[model samples]
Target: MEKIILIGDSGHAKVIEDCIRSQGGSVIAKLDDRYQERFYEEHLIKGPIALIDDLLIDDVKIVISIGSNHIRKSIVERLNIADEKYATIIHNRAIVCNSVKVDYGTVIMPGVIVNADASIGCHSIINSNSVIEHDCVVENFTHISPGAILTGNVKVGQGSHVGAGATVIPGIDIGSWTTIGAGSSVISNIESNVTAVGIPAKVIKREGL
Candidate 1:
């Protein structure tokens, strides 16, 4: 089994850890400040983030357990981590098309259907049964919640989230850090950092729209 280091101790980190273990990867260490000597005793792990290079015992891959795209991108950039070596974490049951581009650190859950030419950004989550049509673009750190559907040529921005069962029309552009509510229908463009809801997705938070 390959050794993997989880890079956080938050609740999301715990979930990622469980996911990793479920995939049959060994958790060599956790790279969080919150866990100190106590973590060592509890998990029998020896290293942390500060000692990342030191803990390379051959055939080890690092996974950023951060939920936010900004945080994940920032850490990866700061560490100068190579995209070539970074692991892309996909559940065994995900169905990705041959022509799709899935970046590193992205998590594709079960029942996801990414059609031809769809681009799933790094560290993004395509949740269960989400349907991404051909030529759709999902930027880094974005989450396509369960049962969401994006028509062809749709662009979902970085750090944005499309809630469960939402449907985005074809050729629409959704900006970064935005949130589309559950069961909403997006007929128009959604700007950055706004929270939109309802059919046709009106801007609820104007400051970021």
Candidate 2:
């Protein structure tokens, strides 16, 4: 069995734990910033996030199961581990095409569909029931939330978050560190570091505003 360590303990981490078990992997530890170093359960141990490097032993793989894109990026940078040490988790029920390329530390949840030629970058999340059409580019540290749809050729930049149930039209470009509001329809290009909401997904707020 593959030994793994999860870097979160929220509901998101719980789902990831199940996913790992489905692939016949064992999660030996779960690290979180909120918890002290101790056993949380008979089969689980909670540890401080700062001690991640020390806990990476016995060829155990790592996954940052946090739902927030910013938090995932920060944790990854702090760990500074090699690419091969990160785990790429794909739920057994996810329908990913053979032509698709998924980088390390990316998680593809159950009910996801990644069509041909799609590229998902490192530490990104393709959440449950999300549809990534052909030729889409989902960059590093991004999250395509549950039920979101990225139509063909959409390019979501690094650290972006496509909110749940949001739909982006074909050939759209969503910039880096941006957020698309839940259930919104993105009809045009979204700029970086902004929050876009509503039917047309306009930038309602920029970073620090």
Candidate 3:
């Protein structure tokens, strides 16, 4: 069993810890800004989130439990976290097909259903209760928020954020750096660096340009 350190200590962090345990690994410690005092208390300890550079051990690996794409990327950049050493944390209850390809540094939360031939890119976040159908391609640095649903053959571009409870129809191509609002329904193709909102998911702005 490898000694692992999770990067967050929130409720999501706890869930990832449980998943790590179920994967036949041991969580040696956790680092977060929320629980400073509890981190020093024996087994379930905490530490600084930004101190990963100072705290990373030779045999230990780091797992990002944060659901936000921006926050996760920022922390990675600030701490200079290694992509090769980053761990993918998947919940035990997640129904991920064997044919699915999940890249490095990605996390599939509880109740997520990733069907066959789906490709989840590097450093992406597939939050809780999401369903990704077959042949769906989610690009790098993207965040599929909780309860989102992507139909078959849907392609979400790099650094995009599909908000919570949102639904993307089949064969839709969502461009890079786009943000789909919560509870929205994407019925058409969305372009890069834009924010899409409402039921039909209209483009509001060219985000991150």
Candidate 4:
């Protein structure tokens, strides 16, 4: 079992912790900016993010475990450790095919179905019950939220968020830093740095560069 150090403590982290436990790993420490330096639980330590290097050691891997794609990517940049020290967590219940490519720091939550030749990139999150169909390419730091579905040959760019219950049809390309609103049906390509909502997914806002 891996001795893990988790960074972040939101509700998302709770699920990530469960995913870790399901993989036979133990979360020995949790670091977040909100907590004071103390033992929050028996055999567990809780402290600020500044305590990261002090707590990290050999045989202990780290997980950002945060829900925000931008913040997760920011922290990933801040972490001085080698990529090999980052942990990729997949819930035991996820049905990932043999041809799927899962990179470091990614998390595949319970009930996720990643079909053949799907490529999940580094630091990405495939949240609970999400279905990533064949040849889907999810880039780094992306989050496919709960109940989201990406059909065959879909390409999701880096730092994107497919909101809960969203559906991107086959061959759709979602650009980087984009957000597809919850329950939206994306039938066409969504460009970068925009928020799209409604059925057929129209861009409602373009984020500043």
Q: For all the candidates, what are their Cα RMSDs to the real structure?
A: 2.6, 1.1, 2.6, 1.2
User: Per-residue lDDT for 86 in model 2?
Assistant: 94
What is the per-residue lDDT of model 2 for residues 45-159, given as tens digits with 9 covering 90 to 100? 7878876777788688999999999999988888888999999999899999999999999999999999999999999999999999999999999999999999999999999
Candidate 3 per-residue lDDT over residues 1-209, each given as its tens digit: 76677887678777777777777788877888765444465665577775666667787788877766778778778777567778887878899999999998787878899999999998888888999999999998899999999999999998899999999999999999889999999999999889999999998877454
Model 2: pairs clashing at backbone N, Cα or C within 3 Å: none
Q: Pairs clashing in candidate 1? A: none
lDDT of 1 by residue, 1-209 (tens): 76787776677666566556657877777776554542474664644567677665467877787766678777777778666656676666677888999998877777788899999888787877899999999998898888999999999999899999999999999999899999999999998988999987898885523
Tens-digit lDDT track for model 4 on 1-209? 99888889889889999999999999998889888775677678898888888878888899998999999989988887799999999999999999999999999999999999999999999999999999999999999999999999999999999999999999999999999999999999999999999998999999974
Q: In candidate 4, list every pair of residues with a backbone clash.
A: none
Worst-scoring 10-residue span by lDDT in model 3: 36-45
lDDT, candidate 4, equals 0.93
Residue-pair clashes per prediction, in order, are 0, 0, 3, 0
Say which candidate scores most in TM-score. 4
Where's the lowest-lDDT run of ten residues in candidate 4? 35-44
Q: Find the 10 residues in a row with the least total lDDT in model 2.
A: 36-45
Backbone clashes in candidate 2 total 0
Candidate 3: how large is its RMSD?
2.6
Residue 190 of model 1, lDDT score: 92
Residue 205's C-alpha lDDT in candidate 4?
Answer: 96
